[model samples]
Target: MDNAGSNQDKGNGKYAGKFPKIAQQTRLLNILVIFAVIYTLYLAKSLLVPLFFSAFVALLLSPLVAFARKLFIPRTLSAGALIVLLVAPFTFLGIELAEPAERWMQSLPKIAAEISKEIEEISSNIDAYATPPAEPVEKERSFFSWFGDDEKSPELSPPQDNTNSVTDKIKQSGIDIGLTLFGNAPFLLAQVLACIVLIFFLLVFGPNLFNVFVRDFPIVTNKRRTLVLVDQIQRELSSYIVTISIINSCLGLATAGVFYYLGIDDALLWGALVALMNFVPYLGGVASCVVLLVVGLVQFGLTSSAFLPAGLFLVLNIIESQLITPAVLGRSMQLNPLIIIIWIAITGWLWGVVGVLLAVPILMCFKIILENLGVFDHWIRLLESK
Candidate 1:
């Protein structure tokens, strides 16, 4: 009986030792899977970007599509109509703004010269009061003097004038860009058409697909939970996107008004630019500010009022971010600023501008799923603003 007991104890100890090894292997497998997924996303971005864009747009327009259905409109017709209505204003705006954008492009050489001049003037003004550091005197018997002093010092070449070279390069770049864009126009247009078609089909058939998916779940509770999770995600995300769109539109209008009052000729363009960039949160605002500062410097020189445009924009942005957005989004949807920045950085690195725009929405979806699953409470806390 004692030998049997010892044998049993030995078996338990052997299994216990293997258990930790097995668990470690599982962890390593999970880590490898995560890395593989990230690599796949990076590699397949060209394909995935359009798909993601279609999905998000479909999600956004889902409510409008539902409304049109209630009016007895065919899903196909309604989807097409909604897409046109959505795209028409932007198409018009782009047509109107093209001339201004071209004008800016044409004036780049002048802008560059003026900016350089301003920088030089500032440096000269600072140099007037600033003491220059004294040059260090070389020792007569320095180490390695024997090796170097025998060799004639190579003659230093005079700096060549690069101004014309820079201008030429810029013109060449513009021409090359124009050529490339013209050449790729068909491909780009096809991609755009494909994405629209995808969105339309998704709108028309998404419900059926989702219902099928939910119905296929093995357990009743899983089916119910899946339905609830999807519904909440769609509802909340749609509402959030719609609200943000309205707010951004109003902010753009307000910015245009302010710029017009400040005597900017292209107030509408600047406003439109701001509104578009505002989609990316913290990084977007900073970029807008930098662009505004450069615009101010170019238009108004280094005067005190030169700072007004950017400064005023900054104030408006602060009010929008700190007061208006918080009040609108509320605590429930609030996310940690750090997580947002990190996620944006990661996505931006992976997929450029489109990824940056999609990062927050994707993160919100992740949070929503976690909430529904009722697991990873610690992760929920980490992601939450509070």
Candidate 2:
């Protein structure tokens, strides 16, 4: 009996010793699985990106579609109409901006030359003031130089025949551009078409899909919880999209007005670009300022006026990001800035520019889901102050 009891105690001791190692292995396995999933997502971006984009667009427009349905409109027609309405303004904006963009492209060489000249002049002035003169030293000829022939070796010149004809160069450039466009056009068109179709179907049938999804949960409480979660997510995401869109549109209009007052060319284009880029958070504001600075330098040279547009843009961005967004979004949607930055970096790495733009929304959705599920409550609390 004593021996048996000792054996049992030994067995218990061995089990206790192995438990931590088992737990550690399980944790390591989970982390590896997570990394593998992320790698798969990165590899499958071509197939997944359009789908994700379509889902976001669908969610954004779902409320509008719902409202339209309340007025007795068919879901199919309402979804189709909403998509068209959403696309038309963008198409119009593109049409309006095309000529100005082309003009800017044509003027690039002139702008570059002016910029280079100004830079050179500034550099010369800085060198004159800030750099001290170096003492001149006499050089001594080597023995090899003394032994060489007095006559200088013939200077090498580029072969005149090797120079490309202007027409040939132009033709080659045109061919290269045409080939590039031809290669990518089909893929881009296909993605756009896929997104549109997916969005339309999702809008028309999203509720039914949700019902079907919840029905598969196999428990009544789970189904109800999922339905509630879905509704909450849709409402919150749609509200966020609407609020941000209005704020961005206002920013764009204000920017346009400022540029117009400042006598900048292509004010509308600049405003539209600003509004579009503002969707990407920190990097977007920087990009807009840089673009304005470049345009300012190209248009006004090195004068004080060259700084005005960029300065105004920077001020406007500060107001919008610091004041307008917070007031509009309120504390409910607030997130840790550090976490947002990290999320942006990770998604941007995984999916490039689109990921950067979508990171905040995706993070918000994730937080909402996890918070509602009551999992990782402490982590979620840490991610938000309120």
Candidate 3:
């Protein structure tokens, strides 16, 4: 009995010693898996980014697709027609804006020179006020300068035309931009084509595909939960996208009107930019303001008018972000600002501007899913105040 008890005790001790090691190995494995997934995502971003974009867009247009279906339209036709309808306005807008955009591009050199000159004048004025007069000192000439074979220090002349250097730099920058756009044009076209195709198929066959996914799970409860979660996600995402889109369009129109009233050039273009940037959270407002500031300075120099456009945009954006969005989205869909900012930074780092735009929507979808699953409920609570 003593021997058997001692053996059992020894076995227990051995197992206890190995448990920590086993847990450590599992943790290491999990970390490795996470890093591997991240690396793969980075590698596949070019393919995946557009896919994700299409998925979100499909979600947004799902309601319209459904409406068409209710009118007895076939799913494929409805999807195709909807995609065309969605894309056509943007296409028309681009064509409409192209000439003006080109004109702006051509004027960039002149604008840059004017801006630089204004900056220099402002700096000089600042220096005149802020800097004290320097004391005059007697300078000793070098022996070479004093020699009869006089070595004169070359007198540096102020540039006769400051625009030349600025123009050259602008031209070089334009060339670089042109080359980049030209090089990427085919690839971007292909991605857009793929995305359109994906969006169409997703819209047409989404329910069928979802049904298949649900059927793959063996447990009935699991299937039910999956359907419930998906339904909730669809509802939340669709509502959010539709509401935001309408609000942004109205905001854009209001912005364009304001800019037109203020006599800002390319008011439509600025409005379009503001509308797109507003899709992003805090950073978007700042970016729009910076663009307006630059344009304002270039157009109006250092006068009070120079700051007006930016100030107006700041106020509008503040109202939209603070009042309009909250009122529309309500407390349930509202997210913690800190979490939104952090997610934006992370997505921005991973996928650049598009990632930043998609960050909140993606986070909201994830939050909805997790909340439904009863997993990370605390996280959801922590990340959303209401």
> What Cα-based lDDT does every candidate model obtain?
0.83, 0.83, 0.83
Model 3 Cα shift for residue 242 (angstroms): 0.8
Q: lDDT tens string, model 1, 147-204? A: 7747554454454342435445645665666666568779777878889889989999
Put the candidates in TM-score order, highest first.
3, 1, 2
Clashes of each: 0, 0, 0
Output candidate 1 Cα RMSD.
Answer: 6.4
lDDT tens digits, residue span 1-386, model 3: 99999999999998998999999999999999999987887778887789899999998888788788899999999888889998999999989888877777666656766666666676668877986665454456666656557544555434333233554565567566656666887988898889999999999998788798679755545777677777778888899888988888888889999999978999999898899998888888899999899889878877889898899999898899889999988887888888888989988878877789889889988887787778877788898863
Q: Which scores greater on TM-score, model 1 or model 2?
A: 1
Candidate 2, residues 1-386, lDDT tens digits: the string is 99999999999998998899999999999999999999998999888888889999999998888898899999999999999998898889889998987677556555655655565666668877986665443345677877777756544443234232443444455456546655876888888889899999999998787787678756556677677778888888888878888888999999999999878988998999899889878878988998899888877877898888889989999999999899889887888887888888999899877788889889888888887778998878888953
The local distance difference test score of model 3 is: 0.83
- In candidate 3, how many clashes are counted? 0
Query: Which of 2 and 3 is the better model by TM-score?
Result: 3
